[model samples]
Target: MVKFYQHTFSFEHAWDNVTYAFWLRYPNPFASHVIGCDVIDRHVDPDTGVLRTTRLIHKQGVMPRWGRHLIKNADAYIVEESEVDPKTQTMVTRTKNLNHVRVMQVEETLTFTVHPENPKWTQVKTEARIVSEMRWGLTGRVENFGITKFMDNSVRARKGMAHILERLRHNAALAGTPVAAAATTGAPLDC
Candidate 1:
């Protein structure tokens, strides 16, 4: 069986700023489990003008103590792929673990866009699916644990993004540039 989760949230910042923050969300205090992140591939689609990126993230101490015997290592790798379309002011990202499929697999997708009621604000939709194929009546327990952990991680991820967004706002102010102007002009962010 698979467990699913969905949520919608908004940030009090512009869509451009929110999308920019997504690229700099790692290494925050809220995500101390993240050990390293590397960009494996990045390029702009010639026809669509959409920016595409693939990243590999290394995380440690992610496994629960009860399940430690099933997996040899406490470390895990995740593959993240994202597409950003500046014209439409939309960004979509998908991520999934690269190891430990037998115990459980968690896949998450996030979409960012401008809020309908407020142009200066950004809306985000998050969806996730967690599945476990383990036998001996352990499937349900494994799936429950996966979903719970996923929810906790989601909260941490949001806090990390908020932290990065606030930093961007402060830097923009110091540079004497409006956040919207900096986002629209594609100014290089300090992140």
Candidate 2:
């Protein structure tokens, strides 16, 4: 058996009272692998008074192929600068023990910054890490181990990403800002 995996990071560095959101999708698999994530859902510091909220979803596959066992089709969603429960108190909140998955570890961090255009706007930064392991034993024990498990992990990521892009367009319309090409000279690098 072999393992395949991918890593990605994204952020909205500058905006006025903006709510950023996006999703991440993993196209392959990893064995005994670690997945780490940090989300800065909200921030109110001396420098920045910005707020961010995120929702993450993950799905994994466990099946045996004709030639070898493999894991495929994992996805995640990270909605930023949304909203949160006032009762809760944390710069970053995480959903540990993701359902029907083996999670070895999870960690996160959030940083705050103040926006010049709107002092009410806050710049938020976050980093997250996750660790996971392959689980083929369960499927192998089942009656049909040959059935391919096309786990769709990116459902939330897809929804969030689309929502954020749409919102950005709407905001631009309200501000009467001209739309530019998707790949502009000043566009941020997609990592």
Candidate 3:
């Protein structure tokens, strides 16, 4: 069985700042489970002028009592791919687990763009799919667990982004530049 989840939310920050915050979202207080993240490849498309990045993330897994026996290693590896188009002012990111596909697989995609009603704010749309093919009548229970864990992780990821955005705003303020302007000017923060 497969479980799907979708959510739409807004960040009270400019789209540029929101996208920038995404790069620094890790190591935040809310995402303590994220142990390490590394950029495997990054480049700009010369023809389209879009920046593309591929990253690998290592996260410590937290399994339920019933699931502990299913998964031997309490760790997960995720692959994240993202594209940023400055001309269109849009960013799209997709992430999925690279391991433990037999037990369960969780895939997520997020899109960021300027809010329609408020240009100063950014809108984010999130979509996720969870699937489990475990036999012995464990498919339903495993899929349920996958969906619940995905939702909880989504909340933490948002909080982590917010924390980074606030820090960027504070630093921009101290530098006598608005966050929006800093994003446009590519001004470096003193942090």
Candidate 4:
């Protein structure tokens, strides 16, 4: 069997401007002129296969804060996707690995979703999963084995975080938007 690497980053927000930028920058070859961001809630019923919450992000000027964050993550994060013999009933039947149990596990699908909130916001939903008839590992990444290392210590993390926030704040100011007075209160842009 062969495996290929696929990288994907998705940002679903309510900011039309940000959505415009995303649609313009990452998803397509053309650039967008929209601004602002918001969240889109999609309610899909697995039992009935009914899908709802079909929202579209549309903006033509400056984007929202969350949108900016999405852009940043797209530029920095490292992602990869590949296919394997997903655990399915058919797979187990053909592999001859197990037959006495009368169970079959075939191919599996893996996907990782990372959404980092603002610097001020700490909690986030970072997920790595396999979607199939059964569940798989939800384990964390191994230590010292990631894409890139930006910081060496708490000071570095704090400093890096501050620099990122400062850049966002600066961009907001440049866009003629009301700068969050407390956005860079103590976080100096030392990078």
lDDT of 1: 0.88
Cα lDDT tens digits, model 4, 108-188, are 122212235432222211222111121132111111111111112213323333444444556667877633443324432
Q: What lDDT does model 3 reach?
A: 0.89
Number of clashing pairs per prediction, in order: 0, 23, 0, 27
lDDT of 3 by residue, 59-146 (tens): 9999999989998997999999999999988999999999998899889999999999999899999999999979999999999988
lDDT of 1 at 36: 88
- For residues 1-191, what per-residue lDDT tens digits would candidate 1 score against the true structure? 99999999999999988998887777799999998888888899999999999999899856677787888987889899999999998999999989888888889999999999999899999999999989989899999998898889889889999998898889889999887676667554222
Give Cα distance to truth, residue 79, candidate 1, Å.
Answer: 0.5
Q: Where does the lowest 10-residue lDDT sum fall in candidate 4?
A: 88-97
Clashes of 3: 0
**Overall local distance difference test of candidate 4:** 0.26
Segments in model 3 whose C-alpha atoms lie over 4 Å from true places: 184-191
Displacement of the residue 69 alpha carbon in candidate 3, Å: 0.6
Ordering by TM-score? 3, 1, 2, 4
